[model samples]
Target: MDTVLTLAADNLLSPLILFFALGVLAALARSDLTIPEAAAKTLSLYLLFAIGFKGGVSVSGHGVDGDLVASMLAGTVLSFSLPFVAFAMLRVTTGLSVVDAAAVAGHYGSISIVTFVAATSVLESAGIASEGYLVAVAAIMEAPAILSALWIAARFSADTGNPVDARDRQGLLREILLNGSIVLLIGSFLIGYITGEDGLVEIESFVVSPFKGVLCLFLLDMGLVAGRGLRSSAKHLRPGLIGFGLLMPVVGAGAGLLGASLVGLSVGGTLLLMTLSASASYIAVPAAMRVALPEANPSIYLTMSLGITFPFNLTVGIPLYLSVARAVGG
Candidate 1:
């Protein structure tokens, strides 16, 4: 109970969470605030690269463990399987079509890097240390959901269909598998691993020491994006879809908790696992969906995931997971 309260109180005051709230409030109140798409994309690249390099540096120093392998396997399984579960639930609960359902499902199955970063902040604030290889686990979780969504599209989409074409299919595959974000993230991680402390030294002032400060700037932009998405989605959102959006994270986190406990993860690691499960797709999956499932209403999935559930997680869910993981793991 003390741990829960501590986590909750600390999370409430975090800059990233506050920035996210600013976005939500601005959107809810119909503010004119916005972030340029190019700038937002650049920030995302920086974040991915910074995190990937840091993770590689940590891993290079510590070396991978058997437990890391197991966790990666678990992440892959969760990525591929969660979509089917989500698709079925969305179909039963909402009026979303099959393609839309699958697209949304893919988002849920995939991991959200922002959420992972936020969780990292939460855990670090509490002085809990996590393994670096979770970065690789995150990378593994991003792509499989695309395959699942495509499979669902082939099997169930109606004639009007998505935006995909034969020529774009190969490109889409490459994008899903080798998105610039993923490439940079993995590449930076490899560089860090190869160079270790010496390599990190060359870029330390830019990457390591200034990380949290940069995160604040990034979250400010994230706030702007979330607010816009929320404003765009306000009318399209319905009670049922919103319910699914909120409930899915809980369901995913519960599964992650069980998995994490079984794997005997550290408190920090468990929190991260819970976060990866709890996070809803907002970035990569949404872009992929915009390309592959254009018929699906962007306002519904993007808003619900980013505007609604994201705030919920940043403000409430991270602390909730930390509290729950400790109680269960203790």
Candidate 2:
């Protein structure tokens, strides 16, 4: 308990979190602070590429092994299955329509790359080591939730008019698989793997030195966006929705803990897995939901995921997961 509180304090006081809070406060106060769209996009790309490349470099140092394979399989299973759990929970807790529930469920099921990166930063600060292949796991975890959500909507929802046609499904699949973040992440990972230490040596100055600063800025932008969403979507913020947003991540983290234990992850790897599972996707899944479940309410899902869940994970969930991982997996 002491350790958990300490970690949480440190995390809350970190520059990243503080900047994020500043952005949120600024937004809530209707201050005109903003990161330009293009700059924000660049920051996103830089963070993804840096983290993915470093993960590959770490994999190069460690070499492929059974744990890597197991982690990937476990991640895939978690991604595919977690939405079912989330959907069931949402149904029990909230009066969301089946489509809205499924849409929210998909966000819970998919991994948030930003959250994963933040966890990595936290782990780094703590001088902990985890498998680099977890980036691949993060990538793998992005799409399966969409499939699960679509399945849920089709299975339970009475609305049949918006059924996705074959072409639409294909396009949605392409969008999921070819999302720019995923592509850059996987592509950079492969590049780093192929080039190995030599690649890292060449680009260390570019990718490593500027990483945390970039992340801080990106998260500042994220805070602004989340704040704006919350401010504009206040009407959609029901108690049940907010409760699910807080509760579901803990449930997902528990599932991740089980999976990580089964796969024999290190304390740090276990924490990363837990963080990935706990995170609700605001990027890939939201875009997919827009395409695949257009009838679903974006304000509800977006506010729940970004405005509620994202901040919760950043401020509380990651530290809590780390404490549990240290207690059990350490």
Candidate 3:
């Protein structure tokens, strides 16, 4: 308990979190602080490329085996199935319409890259080594949740109208599979794998040294976005919905712990998996939601995922996951 508290304290005081806090405060106070859209996009690209490339390099060094395959498969299964759990919970706990619930559930099931990156930073600070192939797992986890959400919406909605009609199917598939984030992540991973250590070495200064600084800036932007969402969308965030946002991550992390144990992930690897599972997609899933469930309220899902859940995971949840993973995985 002491160790967990200490970790949480340390994380809260870190520059990345502190910058994010600054952004949130600035936004809430109606200050003029802002990151330009173009710069934010560049930072996002850099983080994705660096993370994916590093993972590929790690895979190159470690080589693929049964564990990599098993973990990816497990992650996909978790991604596909977690929405059902979330949807069921929502139905019991909130008065959300089927479409809204499924859309929100899909966000829960999908992974947040920023959260995953934060978990990696935590692990690195602790001098822990995790499997590199988890990047691939992250990529694989993105699309399946979207698919599951669509399926749930189609199957259970009081209205017979499919959220995704035949006309929209091809475009939606392309959006999911070829989303710029996914493409950059997978492409950079493959490049890193093909080029191996030599590639990393050649570009180490670019991708390695500035990674943390870039992440801090990116998170500042995130905090700004989240704060604005919360300010504008507070009326939409009811008690039941807020409670769901708080509780669901822990539930998802519990499932992740089980999956990690089954797949025999290492302590660091287990923590990453737990982090991935606990995260809600503010990026990919939200974009897909806009296309698939046009009637669903963006304010609700965005606020739930980014405004509430993201902060919780960063401040409290990461430490909890690390402690649990160490206890069980050690």
Candidate 4:
């Protein structure tokens, strides 16, 4: 208990957590703050590249293993299946329509890159190592939930109009699979894999050493984005909807812990998997929903996930999960 408390304290003291807190506090205070969309986009790209490239380099030395494959497969399966559970839970627990329930569930199904990054920091602080191809696992998790959400939305929102337009459908599909963040992440990971450690040598100055520093700066921007999202949507969200945001991550993390145990992941990897399971997609899913399920409230999902739950998971939840992973993953 002392150890858990200490780690939790450490998490709260971290700059990443602080930045996230700033977002929540600023939003709750109704600050008129904004992060430029272009800059936020660029920061996200940088974060993905730095993390993916580093992971690729690490994997270059580690190579692939059976357990790694098992873990990835487990993560993928969880990503695909968790939404149905979330959808069912939401329908029963709240008054959300099938479309809203499924849409929110899809966010739970997908992975959150920032949450993963935060977990990686916690692991590093604990002097633990995780597999790099988990980056690939992260990429894989993003799309399946989207399909699940769309499937549910289509079923419920037949009357929402223009459900089957070819051009729009194809574009959203392409965006889902080939989204810039996912593309850059996978592309950079593969490039680093191909280049190996030798490749890292050539660009180490760019992707290494300064990675965490860049994360701090990017998180500052994320703070602003998150704050803005929450403040603007504050009036629109009901308590049940907001409560759904908070509850979903806890449910998802419990499911993730079970999955991690089945796959025999290390503490670091297990915590990361749990974090991914708990995180919601502010970027990809919102964009996709805007294109596809236009009636589904972005503010409800985005604000609840990004504003409330994100800071919670980043500051308090990651360390809590790490402690749990250490206990269970051992």
Evaluated with TM-score, which candidate comes out highest? 2
lDDT of 3: 0.93
- Model 4 clashing residue pairs (backbone): none
Q: Rate the local accuracy (lDDT) of all candidates.
A: 0.81, 0.94, 0.93, 0.80
TM-score per candidate, in order?
0.92, 0.99, 0.98, 0.92
Residue lDDT tens for model 4, 1-330: 887899989888888777767765665676765567787777778889988887888788889788768877888888888888888887887788776777788888987898888788778777999877788888888888888888877876665567848887788888889988888999999888888999999988988777777777677777777777766877857777777777888888888888878887777778888888888887888788777777787777788778777877887778888888888867
Cα lDDT tens digits, model 3, 1-330, are: 998999999999998899889888989988889999999999999999999999999999989899999999999999999999999999999999998999999999999999999999888888999999999999999989999998898889867355567879778988888999999999999999999999999999999999999999999999999889888999999999999999999999999999999999999999999999999999999998898888777888999999999999998999999999999987
Please list the residue runs of candidate 1 whose C-alpha ends up more than 4 Å from where it truly belongs after superposition.
30-32, 158-168
Global lDDT of model 1: 0.81
Rank order (by TM-score, best first): 2, 3, 4, 1
Between candidates 3 and 4, the lDDT winner = 3
> Residue-wise lDDT of candidate 1 within 122-169, one digit each (tens)?
776777788788888888888887778777777776653544667797
lDDT (C-alpha) at residue 242 in model 1: 88
Instruction: Give the alpha carbon lDDT tens digit for every residue of 102-168 in model 2.
Output: 9999999998899999999999999999999999999999999999999999999988357898999
The candidate that wins on lDDT is 2
Q: After superposition, which runs of candidate 4 have C-alpha atoms over 4 Å from their true positions?
A: 26-35, 156-158, 165-170
| Candidate 2 residue pairs that clash | none
Could you tell me which residue pairs clash in candidate 1? none
Error of 2 at 116 (Å): 0.4
